[model samples]
Target: MSNLTWQIGCVRVTRIEETLTTIPLTSFFAAATPEALAPHLPWLRPHFVDAQDHAILSIHGLVVESQGRTILVDTCIGENWPESNPLERSALLGDPTSPFLGNLERAGFQRERIDVVLCTHLHFDHVGCNTMRVDDTVVPTFPNARYLFARTEWEHWRAQEDPGFAATLRETVEPILAAGLADLVECDHVVTDEVRLEPTPGHTPGHVSVRIASQGKEALVTGDMAHHPVQWAEPTWGIAADSDGAQATRTRQRILAQHTDDDLLIIGTHYAPPTAGRLVRRDGRVRFASG
Candidate 1:
């Protein structure tokens, strides 16, 4: 695999896949079943362990580097999150792959070098790698980095009563806050000349996309606007996990519209390798330029 890849500037980007599993199509859409997802089989088969069908399973992470700082956009499902669904909980914890931290080290990024860790939202998969397990102690993976989060999102999730939410706040977020390392800002906050956060709510109350602009060139790190490129073609196809499906579709429509005519590079949190791409119009509709 290539050691480094860039997106129009000094910003180097990396895509890391965490796990893959399938779900019943009916769970996400009515009148859809295992057979209904068959049309997507070709696009998903090779990535799954053994593509067998109700749906395709996949999760990913993005690492962004620019100027003198390294930032992780989102963390995958952490090691010990307890899912209410027994099957999912088992698959999450029992997967034979590896500890996510090892993958970071393999990519040549020590946790200490990450000067900032940002999440588009507070979903479990996006915040999993926030902490590391060390001899029964869970600590921030990037000990020297200030964890940045949307102020509204943090406050909203912080008020939730779930154990996982509490674990993320108390064990991951609050520790950084207590240590004076949490930088909570509004959705449109700009962290640097090369990067800024654009509010794209609906998936979560405070979802935001990270925009990287330099030398008059631009790239948008779309956190979770549309989970799959299929959504670029079918704007109404939202995942069951979305907090606000209608709003998510509207957000996707606006973001997609902005990039459809230009050579705007897009990086999706759940997109596969060479995950970044250009958006173009075709047949009176927008399509992601896959490579």
Candidate 2:
């Protein structure tokens, strides 16, 4: 766990890390190449990029404490990987060891105390912790939390014939739905006065970024709209998993333009350490200024 936290007026958000590793730029980004990334390497190194120039990716969940409610953002890859999906397991969790739950409890966020489990999308990494293996059956990890899923996201993945996604749906989401603890919500559903969902599609249909507003302060929890800070410089670069690369680029461009030179904190879902920053114009390009 990075033990990183941010305050947005009346809301406090903490990062509960599950895994942190580097991925080859070519493997993670479609347009990322050594020559193409050379210009931004100065600011990207030491945090976003490693000595080998690989992208540093963090798999973690944000614990949002707002209005006396504890709302968990995206759940990272869980402890147990479905045996039926060896490809997904090997791709997502090559090591299979996870410290997510322990980190949450250490941070004072008990499983039973969680008021909501809000997933931005139904991807394997984002929704893997929705359930846990108990004996021979899978069950909801947060027994008392109401798992919230975007109706469109749920329907989209529910109809997916892809084996990896189907396995994820079976092991993580279906158990919660069967237990009657799931709630299908719109993309822009409000979780609280200080916290709400902002529809930022294209990474996946029905994908949403979380918006927090309180005491005149604001922040946006980007759910893969832009994976790395380099995207602020080149919005056209997208990950391989993107359903619509052009739409994802457009969303990034619109949001970056809207928040450029503004005070709104940009909390990236897959960013490395010092993950939150503000967008600003520098050298005729949008840059992420991490504090």
Candidate 3:
């Protein structure tokens, strides 16, 4: 398990770890196909840990506590999610006695205390805890908070017409909407003066990164921009979930360049513990200086 740290501001941000599993460079680069990945394979081997385990990706979430509000940005895969994808589902189930709930308690938050819940996108991993099953019906996980979502995101997924998509809409978003507890806002919506949304699409039709600013300092909660630090070094290597690879690449480059020379901190949704760090440009390379 990695360590956790709190970065204080108008948003008292907390980094919470759920689980970490390493993936071989092969599995990740496989998306590149044999022809494209062959030359890079040798170069990547040294940086990656070998095993039946190469995907050392950690499933985690960011809890933004601002104005007495405990807002969870994304919920890592929840326990017992009914997905058939073994690797993801296995990551979910691997922690049979996960300290997620306990960790929240220790950090001084309870489900009922959360004032708003926001998800960067509707990926299964990002919104896993949006709802939980009851005796027969699904219900909002944050009983008293209004869940926020990007308007375009909800619309795009709703139009997909997939059965599982419908299930997620019904089980997670619709119920919250029905209870008048869902805030569907545009890409530029501001949850508060301190917390606002930045339209960082491409990963998904409506993916957005959260921006927090206070005391002349700021941080961007980059939800899945680059799954890990390595991606900062190779922005063109898009993730499998990205809806538009070329556009995603453009957005990644823009974000990295904009923050690389400045003092802005980036809190990657999947970054190793504490997850909060700064981006730096060295020589001709960029990397996350995890702080």
How good is model 3 by TM-score? 0.86
The order by descending lDDT is 2, 3, 1
> Which has the better TM-score: candidate 2, or candidate 3?
2
In model 3, where do residues sit more than 4 Å from their true spots? 1-3, 30-53, 83-87, 91-99
Q: For residues 1-291, could you state the per-residue lDDT of candidate 1 as single tens digits?
A: 343355667667776666555655456455344564455445444432134444444566677877877888887776745334334545644573435667677788788888888989987678777876689776677889888899999988988887766765665567667777789999999877788899998888899999988877788888888765556756777877777989998998898767787867887666555456767666675666655
Provide the RMSD of all predictions against the true structure, rounded to 1 decimal.
3.3, 1.3, 3.5
lDDT winner: 2
lDDT per residue for candidate 3 within 146-198, as digits (tens), equals 88999999999988876666666666677788878889899888887788889
- The list of candidate 2 runs beyond 4 A from truth reads 87-94
Residue pairs clashing, model 3: 21-55, 21-56, 22-54, 22-55, 22-56, 23-54, 23-55, 23-56, 24-54, 24-55
Judge candidate 1 against the unseen true structure and give its global Cα lDDT, from 0 to 1: 0.71
Q: Which prediction has more favorable TM-score, 1 or 2? A: 2
Q: Write one digit per residue (lDDT tens) for candidate 2, span 1-114.
A: 349999999899999998787788877886788788898889888889899988898888999999999999999888657666766545655577778889999999989999
How far residue 92's Cα lies from its native spot in candidate 3, in Å, is: 4.8
